[model samples]
Target: MPATLLIPLYRDEVAPRFDLAGEALLVHLDADGAELSRSSVLLAHASSEELCRIALEEKVRVVICNGIDDEFWQYLRWKRIEVIDNVMGPVDEAIARFRADALRPGDILFHRSDA
Candidate 1:
């Protein structure tokens, strides 16, 4: 199965992006460790809302990121997609941790917006 990881891109480990919607999502195929960067990234020229649309259209299964708005959290949860928040450390390490099942439904996460 595939996982959707929503990561808030920051110069360092702290702080949110200038735009609340201006976040990057790294999608990875759990089994093979293959990343879907080129085919999935929709922030090159589109608005954040558009990118969110793309994620839903692409059937994003998981979202791993630093932080997300309460609205998007509810939307994703309503769609039954898994989400991970407050992610730090290297992206590779995060992925590995997820695979090891060390991460829980709300381990690195908070309210699902729906809650």
Candidate 2:
């Protein structure tokens, strides 16, 4: 099964916000990770509640987001959905970290503005 990525729509590195749900949900069958279109990320419009619900319904194994609200994070944790917080990178790089085991469930990755 492919790992799923949940991203914010408005951020530079995040996938583009498209569709009524407003987020790019990349589901690829590569353990190494897959590249996604910047125009297809639509996470900005969806609230934490909505995203959490989406993750659950989609059976998303992983979520890489710019930031996470406390309530949403807690909910996701309860659901056993791994979250990579404060992630800053291209979609592929983040997924690489996950595949390499360099990224942890509650990791606080830094996406520098300079990067």
- Each model's lDDT comes to 0.54, 0.58
Residue range 10-45, candidate 2, lDDT tens digits: 444543221223555555435545443222435546
lDDT of 1: 0.54
Ten-residue stretch with the least lDDT total in model 2: 12-21
Candidate 1 lDDT, tens digit per residue, 20-92?
5344545556555455552324365424456456568767777665556777767777888676766644555
Q: How close is candidate 2 to the true structure, as a TM-score?
A: 0.62
Q: What TM-score, to 2 decimals, does candidate 1 have?
A: 0.61
Query: Ten-residue segment with the worst summed lDDT in candidate 1?
Result: 10-19
User: Which residue pairs show backbone clashes in model 1?
Assistant: 4-62, 4-63, 5-64, 6-63, 6-64, 6-65, 7-65
The lDDT leader among the candidates is 2
For each candidate, give its TM-score against the true structure: 0.61, 0.62
